[model samples]
Target: MATLQLSGVCKSFGTTPVLHDIDLDIGEGEFVVFVGPSGCGKSTLLRLICGLDTIDSGTLTIDGEIVNDVPPAKRGIAMVFQSYALYPHMSVASNMGYALRLAGTPKAEIERRVEAAANVLRLGPLLKRKPRQLSGGQRQRVAIGRAIVREPNVFLFDEPLSNLDAALRVDMRAEIAALKQRLGTTMIYVTHDQIEAMTLADRIVVMNAGRIEQVGSPLELYRRPANRVVARFIGSPRMNLLPGALVGDPAAAEIGVRPEHVRLAGVGHGLAGTVRMVEHLGSDLFAHVEIAGVEERVVARLDGGREVHVGEAVSISVDADTSHRFDAQGKRMAPAHNDRRTA
Candidate 1:
């Protein structure tokens, strides 16, 4: 019952446009993550959905109602911000119950709801502790618990874990995932971290320059990116792009192969390159090489234990079946058609 739909959504900051012609549908009980580089308007889109910012033009609907003009507080959405935003002077229980109390809920009702949320968040033992006394993770839990007590139709998280350290971010990610399963409420989260998007989202909406580039399950986008920009964005080391001629394709403007897909082979059998640098991460090794005719360096991934020295001669194999072809306009080309031209 918490479905959200945005139709032709547009937003502007003064004269400059920030989001453009956005159209999306989020099903009830689905966890969707918005991911993009900073300044891409993902967080702005979240604000529009939460009613914190008004859209320049679009229809915003929740469930069956048009909520474009609804105030954030009345929109049946609760937002958890990047900052914990807990009141340092307030006890955890008080902070969680404050909203209900302000709404004139009976004291007993407030206590009941707060207790339920606290138990769900495992903050029962810390209910009497002030925010100042809590660790970063506990403060975040209190922030989430505050939203839980409101029982909104949708949960909107704007980089809620970005403030935490790496270890705490991983732990909180698991906690949030469990919360989603327990609540089964529609949740829209925004983050620039691809790992967070990949690990947590049921589906990820990849945005770029105020527009959505692609939307799909994590692996789908990772394996079959719609275009060049997406091909470069989703992966850690990113896909290695080379001129089509490097792969013996005359028609394709570019061909992309993931670092992991680039196999080190015997000399003269694959693309010739000299290793420029090697990054060893204990489990994996990434070798950066300068391939002939390739404008940018190509990176190849290997087992961590492999000893590859800088300036070593190496060749990388990229199979046709595994490579992605893009035309001059940066759009992905059909494999059959693309291969026919090469054949």
Candidate 2:
């Protein structure tokens, strides 16, 4: 495993700057994920770490050694890309050992490493099968096994599961999680999917338009976002925002509440609105409410069995104590160092 540090990292393309003065530290054997929407530079940042691209102005150190000029092959890092990139003609064993073979590893050592990686990935039974004979998930595992054989100091994954279907994606996620436990190697993953980041990362680096927005553990980010961007992005249905005036807070521009926090208030108690729609999942029902002054529809999460219908008049209340207050500039304005917003 290796520790990675990026100080004042900046990158650009022609006249358009991508990554700003970014700084991050990754501990040895840590699983850090860079997550954000497309055009956010997550993939570019991964490429920079893999030495596929150069940092315009920054110091990238690995294991406390400055490797700004180090070649990718010498960086002790292995990267798995979105594409499987396996050779169709090569058997799984050959594909997994190809890098070692090219690196001039002895044939016997290559065989040993291949066996070890296959054992780790559970690909032993399929070693003789060509890429064409393997399933998509199996092919991806082979690609990962290819990297595992090298025993690199760090592993970098760039949206490796995005190409798979939803079910396969979930399966691959479990497999990758198991791989992390089995190897305990330093892994940096890049994904636009927040769920992937939340589930896979020890720390998630949230980015927006090439700049790092926030970095925190999954629950820390979900429960206490630093700004509106993170508050709206991290959640599955996203936190709902209403004009702070509704909460009688003149200093707050917006009052952010999660769907789960938007509870059903009694008649005329809170915002009087009509249910726009209701989405029933297994255990939760999300009701979309349209109010007079609110721009976007307010969505409230309730018990799935609750029989809410479209066009039904309802009153929904925002739990101020469970809500967040944001300044006009969208900065979180908690009352104290650790205090959340309260009525």
lDDT (0-100) at residue 68 of candidate 2? 87
Q: List the residue pairs that clash in candidate 2.
A: none
RMSD of 2: 2.1
Stretches of candidate 1 off by over 4 Å are 336-343
Cα distance off (Å), candidate 2, residue 297: 1.1
Q: Once model 1 is optimally superposed onto the true structure by TM-score, how far is the C-alpha of residue 67 displaced, in angstroms?
A: 0.4
TM-score of each: 0.95, 0.95
Compared to the true structure, candidate 2 yields what TM-score?
0.95
Which parts of model 2 have CA positions greater than 4 angstroms off? 336-343
Q: What is the C-alpha lDDT of each candidate?
A: 0.91, 0.89
Worst 10-residue lDDT window for candidate 1 reads 334-343
Q: What's the count of clashing pairs in each model shown?
A: 0, 0
